[model samples]
Target: MLVKIEGIVIRARSFGESNQVVQVYSEHLGKLSFVARGAKKTRSRFSALTQPFTIANFLCFSSGNGLPTLNQADLVHSHQAIRQDLLRTSYGAYWLDLVDHLFEEKEPNPGLYRFLKTAFDWLEQEKDPDILTRMVECKMMAAGGYRPILHACAQCGSEERRPVTFSIYQGGFLCETCKHTDSHAIPLSDATIRILPVLVNLPIDRLGEITIKEETKQQLERVIRSFLMEHVDIRLKSWDILEQMRKVWAASDDSTST
Candidate 1:
């Protein structure tokens, strides 16, 4: 069966010598795999189209069961800016890894497809990639149906204004009284709780207008990390790579400043 799909190349790995296996999140097909027969060749037709962060339209010969064989690919958008920087590359890889690992195949979710496309666009242009990365993580969790309950206590459902606690396992913010229910709950500031919803609910383009403080960013980052790790329960190899890269960048910065 022949099929056409409009999607972004989330991942690309060499198959053998001249072939490449690509994972794409398409508007029509949520997550699909394609094998580009000669993608590794220097002058291959699909060479440019079969790359991470490249959005394209693909023509494939589908077996209707497993991996599809790529016949042709036409480029739609090349996120070149993201590829130019190491930090951006790592964050892009993390996004691709999360979608590839968590999203189920053949499930058509146009909302998520659009969200991811917007995220890549933002990643390519946005100066504050760290804050953008955190925002995307929150959006991903909500899109995946694990939306954190930030408005009220996750355990007791209290909406009164008071200090709250964050419970990754219990799944949201808990009021002071309900904090005892989750012994592991960590204190969450009123500001952090307020901005949690804003970060997730705000439109992507407007993200530039909002400024996130370093301390607040750290809090959100911790919450996001714990929430994803505890709830999804999956080990992300990309996270390790990002952490290592951060250390290297920090050391390089320190040396330059001295």
Candidate 2:
């Protein structure tokens, strides 16, 4: 039972001293794991193809029951540049971690695979990493059926003429009258409201073209973090590492500002 797959290396772990356990998000197989024999010990052929963020062509053998065993792997593109920069690497790991948490195993979703490929391409080209990361998160959330409501109120289905209250619990915006009654809703800006559709619908490659104010970007980032927490509901270990890095960057930013 030989299968060929095109996928991104979402995760890799050591299997003894000579092999590896890899998890990949494939176009045909959704999220799947493979055991690469001798991929670590002897500088084997599949060495380069097994790293995180490496897009690869894999040949595997399985009984369609459990984790597949890797027979061979051919490197496609490594997105090596993404690993060179600290910020890019952190964001990329965050993106892949989200993907790992959001997706189900062996449920084929070509749309997600393509979306991630585009995202990696953008990151590889040295584009705005944060905006691209947000864009991918937005699109991936939508694909997982947790799409955010921005244009109108999610509660009463009202399309009011002003900024509305976004409720993660209610799953969208609420009108002023409705928001007054609900204690959990948060205020949103019109700019953030208007851009939700574009973020969900546009291609990732063009994400850099979307101009947003710093305040609006903060709002959107908060919204996304809240949304993911509500839906995914798992603490990521990498998130803490990223937060430490963000604080370092924040201090640098503050110094520059002063």
Candidate 3:
């Protein structure tokens, strides 16, 4: 039975001679891998539709086989700008890598699909791609059950407190009383504790000209990094590359500021 699905190409890699294995995050069918026969050829039927970030409609089927086999594909969203820019591509690839590595196959995530599609569009016009990427991470975390309890202390359920520690081990804020629970809890500024919930709730597209301090961004990064390490349950090589690119971007920014 041929199944028609709309999805974004999260990954496409060489399988055998003149063939490719393509992974797509479909809104209706979740993540699925299809073998694109002869996709490697320049004039192959799937030549353009088999690459990462290409949103397309696919006619595919799994005939009791290891992977679904694609019959035909048509491009839906070109996403040409992301591919043409290096920094935008880096962050965009980071998003794709996170989805490919962290998410489970055949798990329908419509909310995530919408969020991802919108975020990718924003990446093309990303004023600060790193910050945009961080926003994406927060949204994905919320969608993936890793949302941190920033509103109140995760332990005592008390709100509006100072000197709270963000406990990655405990999965949220730790009040001074509950701080003893996790020795590894990192101290968060009152402002950071206040701002995190905002970021978690904020829409990615509306993040224009809303400048957050560098210190606050770093603080958020540390907290999110630990949260992912503790909960997401996977390490990504793309994360390391993103970090290296971030350093280079930062150094360039610093030099231009002087």
Candidate 4:
């Protein structure tokens, strides 16, 4: 079957000496894996289109059993700014990895596709990548059906709780009354708690309108990481690299401060 679709490149790997195998998360087809012939060659037409994070329109022939063969590709957005910057690339790579793991092949999710495209646009425009990443993580969790309950206590469903903790195992916040339900629950600051739902549902376009304190952002990161670890089974290579880069950046900052 011949199909034309708009998609973002999620994964790309060398197949043969010259061909490349690319996995794209399409706006209409969800995720599709296709082989781009001679894409590894410097002069190949598909070379740039097969790159990670590139959003493009693709024409392909699917056999219904094995991988599809990419016939032609036209660039919509190369996201060159993101590709050139290390920090943006790390966040972008993690988002792609998360999407690749969260959805099944050929399952159309137009909502996710739109969200991802917007995220890339913002990242390229120099939005705070850390905040953007956190927002995307929360949104992705919600899309994957692993949304953490923050509106009320996950245990008793009460809205009048004074102090609450985040429970990864229980899948949400626990009121002070129910804190004993999970001894492992992480204590959350009022600020962090207040921002959780906002991050989960905030429109990407309005991300610049709000500012998050550094301390609260760190707390939210830990909570989101723990929640994802408890709920999602996928491992991300970009996350490890991003952590190492963060450590190096911290060391550099410390040196500059001293």
For each candidate, give its TM-score against the true structure: 0.94, 0.92, 0.90, 0.95
Can you tell me which runs of candidate 1 are displaced by over 4 Å?
63-66
Q: Model 2 reaches what TM-score against the true structure?
A: 0.92
| Residue range 1-258, candidate 3, lDDT tens digits | 788999999888899999999999999888888899999999997888877788999998878868888998888887888888766777888898888776788988888898788888777765767567778888878877788887788888888554479999878989888898888999988778777887788876677847878898889889988898888887888888877877887799999999
Displacement of the residue 117 alpha carbon in candidate 4, Å? 0.5
Which residue pairs in candidate 4 have backbone atoms (N, alpha carbon, C) closer than 3 angstroms, thus clashing? none
The Cα error of candidate 2 at residue 148, in Å, is 1.9
Q: How do the residues 1-258 of candidate 4 rate in per-residue lDDT, one tens digit apiece?
A: 999999999888989899989999999989889999999999999998988899999999988877889999999999988889877788899899898888888888798789989999999998888898888888888888989888888999998885479998998999989999999999989898888888888888899898998999999999998899789966788899888877887798999999
Clash total of candidate 2:
0
Positional deviation of residue 35's Cα in model 4 after best superposition, in angstroms: 1.1
**lDDT for residue 102 in candidate 2, whole number 0-100:** 78
Off by over 4 Å in 4: 256-258
RMSD of each: 1.6, 2.0, 2.2, 1.5
Per-residue lDDT tens digits for candidate 2, residues 220-252, read 788777877887576787777777887888899
Q: Each prediction's Cα lDDT score?
A: 0.85, 0.82, 0.84, 0.89
Please give the RMSD of candidate 4 to the true structure.
Answer: 1.5
In model 4, the Cα lDDT at residue 241 comes to: 89
Model 3 poorest ten-residue lDDT run: 124-133
